[model samples]
Target: MPELPDVEQFRTFFHAHATGRTVRSVEADPTIVRNTDPAALDRALRGRRFEDPDRHGKWLIGWTDGPALLLHFGMTGDLVWSGEDPHRHRHDRLILAFEDGNELRYRNMRKLGGVWLAHDREEVAQVIGALGPDALSIGRSEFGERLARRRGGVKAALMDQTFVAGVGNILADEILWQARLHPRRRIETLDEAERATLYTVVRRVLREAVRSYDYVGRKRSWLTHVRGIPGGTCPRCGTSLQRATAAGRTTYFCPRCQAADPAVGSGP
Candidate 1:
């Protein structure tokens, strides 16, 4: 799943590579672009230039003088610089061909997310109205306050889009592991230092993850490296990392290093 870091990367890329470029043509798979009429989209945006790349959580918005192009990269969706092959890639759902012969293509294997047309940023807000303050933009004081008011486990609070935007299941685990907190640790049990640690680590982990480009280009860490693998052991404490479905998402944490959940098992 594309999170804040991933969408931020896309936003940066879109600004640098595609902004100010004139759209010559647009070809879209009708099945993928759900919100706007294909003909209407092309007519409204064909001659316009892409400008002002912005992101809110996992959503990326690139706009022109006219309608804004909102993108949500679902599980397998990606926006890549279109290569030579045009029709060869079946997943290339939405392709915006530029006047310069280059293209920016939106591809999705699962079709979970698609393109949305918004007249302005305010309209984009209406589309994603349920989202709370962006994860990267909120200050530490606000983050602490939000967590202090939450009744659920810290991981669940972090992963809630309505509470704090952009974090997903994988990121929730990574941030919790880095802060040395159990996935099921209640927010009320957090001390000032622990709260500080969570806030600091959340931004740090996300920045590093985006800087590393999806965490693939960087050295594998104890927390991020264990994601998606079954029965993976902790790289830090050498403990068997336990897994459970917490708040409906699969959660992973080190038993020895993060045994702070009072309701669950033995703790430090």
Candidate 2:
């Protein structure tokens, strides 16, 4: 699924190409990933202009003369800009053609993501209401407040949309590793200082992700580089990395670095 960072990258691309552009026509082929009726989408978006680049959690909100388009790139969805439509990609669920003859394609290989049209602000709020504060924009105090309220494993809490939106599997793992806290570590066990550090780590990791265009593989300082390695070793401690399922997602951690139990000498 496209997390906050990947969505941030998409937001950047949308701002550069799609924002403030007048729509000439609309195309809907959500035979694979439809949220609203294709005809309804076309009716609402055609001849309208996209204004106000807004995103919350993993959802992108695009405003038009009619309804706002709400987008969620589930697993394998992305936006591509094409000067000319060569009829190239078959998985484009939504295509918006601009007055300038440029094309914006919302392509999803697996077709798991969805696009919805919001007829009013209440509708948009309903779509966004299910999500927690966006991981990137939440304040440090708010992060700590929310983290303090989680009643499950730290990883699961981080992944929960109702707890903190946009911090998905990879980001949770990376942030936990940076904070030297195990994925399974219970939130109640975290101290004010530890939680504060985690807040800093989450912001740092998320910012780094947006800065690198979701290319953590190219960064040596990122623990994501070693995540799920065939014979992965912790870059910080050189101990062989361990993996397990947390919140139903494959989680990576260093046993020597982030101990299983923090009460009994959890390593710093």
Candidate 3:
């Protein structure tokens, strides 16, 4: 699934190609248009000039002078730009034609995600109201406060969208591994210093992931490189990594590095 970093990349790409450009036309697969029909989507965005785009969690908001276009990339959705006569992929569910003859396509292979139309800012807020603060925008003090409030395992707290938005299974695992906290360790058990380390590591890991464009571009030293494979070893130490279910998702961590004991907190 596309997380915060992946959505940030999509937001950047959307802004670069569509900002200040008027929508000349729209073609969409009705099945992929959520909350509104295909004709309604066209009517809302047909001639509106796109302003700077914004992203909240895994959701992408295309701001315009009128209605806003909201997108959730679900598991396999992507936003791609194409030339005037660009070959259309079969999975291209949504297409927006700019006055310059260029096209922006929302391609989804699995069709799990869809698009939404918001006529007003309040409508936009209604869509994302359930989500907590954007993970990247949380300050140190706020992150510490949020972390301190959670009674569940630290990994579960991190993965909960209502606790802190944008973090998914992959990011939760990466953050815990980097912070050297066991996935099942209770948040309250963390000392002040440990909490501070977690706050710092969360922002650092997220910022680095955003700059890398996506998780696949993460460095070899990152646990992501080996976490998915069987018998994978920790990059920090040569110790064999362990795998188990945490927060209802498959999780990976170096047992030697991130022992279950709360006192054990040492990481690169």
Candidate with the larger TM-score of 1 and 3? 3
Question: What TM-score would you give candidate 1 relative to the actual structure?
Answer: 0.91
Q: How many clashes in each structure?
A: 0, 0, 0
> Candidate 3, residue 102: CA error in Å?
1.0
Judging by lDDT against the true structure, name the best candidate.
3
State the displacement of the C-alpha of residue 118, model 3, in Å, after optimal TM-score superposition.
Answer: 0.4
Clashing pairs in 1: none
Among these predictions, the greatest TM-score belongs to 3
Candidate 3: worst-modelled 10 consecutive residues by lDDT: 259-268
Per-residue lDDT over 1-268 for candidate 1, one digit per residue giving the tens place of the 0 to 100 score: 5888888888987887789999998888877776787887888789999987889888888889888888888888877785544553778888888999888888889989888888877888888778978888788999988888888688878888889899988888888888888888788888888899999998888778877775732446647686656777887867788887787888888888887654455444
**TM-scores vs. true structure, each candidate:** 0.91, 0.94, 0.94
Model 3: per-residue lDDT, tens digit, 93-138? 9999999999999999997879999999999999877887889989
Superposition error at 219 for model 2 (Å) = 1.2
Name model 3 segments beyond 4 Å from true. Answer: 263-268
